[model samples]
Target: MWGRQMFHFLLHWMLGAICFGFLVTAFSVLLSQLVITVVWCSLVIGASIMQDRDLSEYSPTGSSTSKHLSCSHALCEESPNCASPKQPCPYTANYYSENTTSTGFLIEDILHLASSSDRGSKRLVQAPIIIGCGRKQSGGYLNGIAPDGLMGLGLGDISVPSFLAKSGLTRDSFSMCFNEDDSGRIFFGDQGVGTQNSTPFLPLEGKYTTYVVGVEGFCIGESCVDRVSLQALVDSGSSFTFLPDNVYEKVSKEFDSKVNATRTNFEGSPWEYCYKASSQQLLGIPSVTLLFSVNSSFVVDKPICLVYGTQGDNHCISCCFFEV
Candidate 1:
């Protein structure tokens, strides 16, 4: 069946795994959709070998099902360190974090996928995908940032979704939906429903590398900041939302002027706008909304998040805003 094989996967809050007969787990795997390349840490080259102290426990053993990709492959041309046609393809990917990088060789492996059929039947399919067998990592990777691996869902020929599409297994599209509990589902080849709200993906540097969207501005209750004209990346990998210093100042000032809660500081917390308030008081706080083009808006129903004390008690409400 053409374009009927829609792959599905489950997503946890901070961790997720794709079922491939066995599990391939990663830290922030589902949320790591912002990355441009799919890279998994090799057990032999994991944090145990690294000089850094912090590292993830999950690591997959080198499987016999995988084989090194030859440099002659068309995908090898995209590798920055492809040398000889007879050699294994080498690749290196850098992250937004300073000094963070994943360097390794490319390998071809069969991904076991489960798809639902038209008659509500389930079928298993095996598709070949190109993945980076990370032999070494630096910086954030050692600091618990996707220590196990990263399954990149960003636009690229080497990404898992792209490989599936090129193999004629499904359409070139995917969707990710996260619930309030942080659990979610990832559907490959899904075009989404007609009634769903949508926004156009803008290009970056003449190319679409990651999910970039144009923002008209932000709104804190009735007061709105119009024409801010911010182009932001829709990054689920990041735990907190970040804004420019100028924009952050404008937003923080507006929110502080309207809220009745007293501003206080929480030790060891990065949030600058912490307030001493009760659960009932938090409910009265104004909602924040991101204004987009074509009457589309993303609303944050709960802007104030609870910051717990050392004893695990709800001490204060903090606005999740990090300056970029």
Candidate 2:
């Protein structure tokens, strides 16, 4: 009962801050095994295409020219009291106005994962996927990475992790290891990473089951932001870090003061404070750290880095964070 309540509070609380990452779950596969999927949004002019016949009446601008566009639920045209055909369909996700429609824009496909074996039969695993057409993400450091959608690692029947477990190809466990040379690898099945930093995993059993961790607080520079034993989700799929409302306000303030560089002049930088990267600019940027709680009296420090990328001529000096 308490677990469910915590998940409920987290769901409502997370909306106040945009804490999602590029991928909800980290990609894991045996060495050299192709066991992950990428969910990138936005289709090119002709690079890829999907069928959405339901939205044939909508123009590129989302305006409806056909007065015959009726509500799908009613199954027929309405009287004068009903929604006009010129207006958007009242039953669709877009209410009564010609606006962005998700029906005709989404697509799906089958993905096959290759296993680590190479003896006789290739360990081939198949997974289902959903795709969508939309505008690519831009600006800030995320412009390059987030333009494509995330490969889902959430706790859903269709998520990549679930696919592996469903196919009997894996035991639903994976680990990631990073080397000093800027390269890393993921291992699946019973091959887990050996570490003493492991903690309790709270499996959110609601609509979106996600990997959430217990967070006590964050130590930023010399200041520590209080988290009051609230929970946080660790999603490497994201390009930036998101903090809860109360925690964010305090952390951002400390980060801003510590950096002390001139604010970025770029128009579309998503970070709250952007500074040009230089010898002097580098001095102002400080390392933001994370503190996690494993049990009573057992705490761990998660060292976080803040290295924002460039947008055209500007060189960003901090990673993305959100008040969400």
Candidate 3:
């Protein structure tokens, strides 16, 4: 029989710590971005895991309680290189960034979770979960990207959420709400409010491994500048929003034309359409909105962001955008 479990965890920015009964580990939240959860292996010195405990006791490879998943496991079947049933299951993940990748083996370990009782008291529960013990990492990972480890919330057979759901520990659903101060809470097995707006998830190559939604077009203020039919992936792990090259040009140009400010540039910055404007002037800037099917729309209230220059005297009004 399947059981439904719901739990909440606090997040500071993109990082959060989950207690595993005997140990506490910090992870970067990759909401609906990655297909598998990953923890750096003991081989990587100076990792948070190693600094938190003795090398012998906390090592995933050395821990007697941790078990290597066999290649014959169901999760291992997704790998194209799984040949030997007796061998450990291997996994690899490639990111959108160039030369960024994580390759490792899968292992099973116990995860400690806090659950609320019917009386409103909290209690600890243990469950087995599969994790990718990453042995090697490259590219942005070495440069403070998920410096500790990653907690993948994407849709996949091996993801933590999916594993918990398959084990009948929780319903296969989760929700994340981020606050203005960069703090947020995540609720597992949460079915959101009935009045909330929703967009349908689109399938990719006949598989629903990532959250993809259809976008009809974009609006800058009251004017609808461009009409686009594309599928957008909702990824919270990304610090900035990305758009197609053609759409990016139209939107940026439209935004620049509407604002009454001088155009400026910051060397080595990703923002191309920056403006030299005062705070009072920015208040009159137009808002950005995304149009979806069924008349559902997402509004960007504060589209212009204040970016300080190196000298700290100059300010630039920037929008998060990168052509994909």
Candidate 4:
């Protein structure tokens, strides 16, 4: 009877210890899972709140720094009527045309003038003749013929003849667009020779369309919408595109406000710059358009080339292109 009693006591203790161990293990598992859930929720909520705050700071209607102004408008502030009714925007010839060469003029005149020993005198004569034109300054030069064998022109110390040879549009057959008038109008063809203006002489429109559109504000992105269109130049030889400092600030803010937005920070580039893109609205920012007037008669479209960050907190870079 004692032995039986002792057995019953031992069995009872063993069962109680087993139950206690199971209860402790279950409680520990549940508590650990709850802690993990709470931590994840906190992180998500904090991220959402931070994003909202950043967006709030960037809304277009919010503050002076939030607003976007174009390069022309910025220039206007310093001079009366620079922006609008107070001042009249300057006007020039419109050179944009499906076919500028069809407007018959002298091709020989352009060649004779450019070939002159007197660079200064020739410039005076040729400057007004080149149409749809702007000057380009480049450190290096490359020559290649248009599909039709027309020679290319760019600025460098290289001799024009040697440049032409390198391009394959040897002096024997290539004609440069040497006579573009101030209105961005260009005229080309071998003058006094059997050569006439070639059709589709320069495929400039295709090459520079991106650069022009970007400058004109046709691009869609947080920063592009907030920054006003600024001065545009057609640069074919630049390694990449650039924008002024003021533009980068307004663009950078847009990405910072959104979750999963690409960082608009440039630390690994040969040049320091940043960029961001999104599909939503930011401060009612509007798209931009650029117009090019040639010979005060035609208007053509330019393309966006590049977008990058500037050094200043509010600085940005913008560059556009025009077809040849």
lDDT of each: 0.61, 0.40, 0.64, 0.24
Clashes per model (N, Cα, C within 3 A)? 0, 9, 0, 64
TM-score of each: 0.76, 0.48, 0.77, 0.22
Per residue, candidate 1 scores C-alpha lDDT tens digits across 60-134 of: 233545677888888785444556677888777765556777777777777777888669999887888776777
Winner by lDDT: 3
Tens-place lDDT per residue, model 4, 1-324, is: 111111010000000000011112221111110010000102222233344331111112222222222224322222343454434222121112211111111110021123333254433122111111111111110111000111122222122332334444334222323223512212222333554222111222344211121232323332234425443323232323344445434433432333232335456543332335443422223332322222111111211113444643321123312221
Ranking by TM-score: 3, 1, 2, 4
* lDDT ranking, high to low: 3, 1, 2, 4
Off by over 4 Å in 3: 1-34, 43-58, 61-65, 77-83, 117-121, 267-269, 305-308, 311-324
Cα RMSDs, all models: 8.0, 13.7, 8.0, 35.8
Q: Write out the backbone clash pairs for model 1.
A: none
Model 2 TM-score on a 0 to 1 scale: 0.48
Error of 4 at 309 (Å): 19
Roughly what TM-score does model 4 have, to 2 decimal places?
A: 0.22
Q: Candidate 4, after superposition: displacement of residue 23 in Å?
A: 79
Global CA lDDT computed for model 2: 0.40
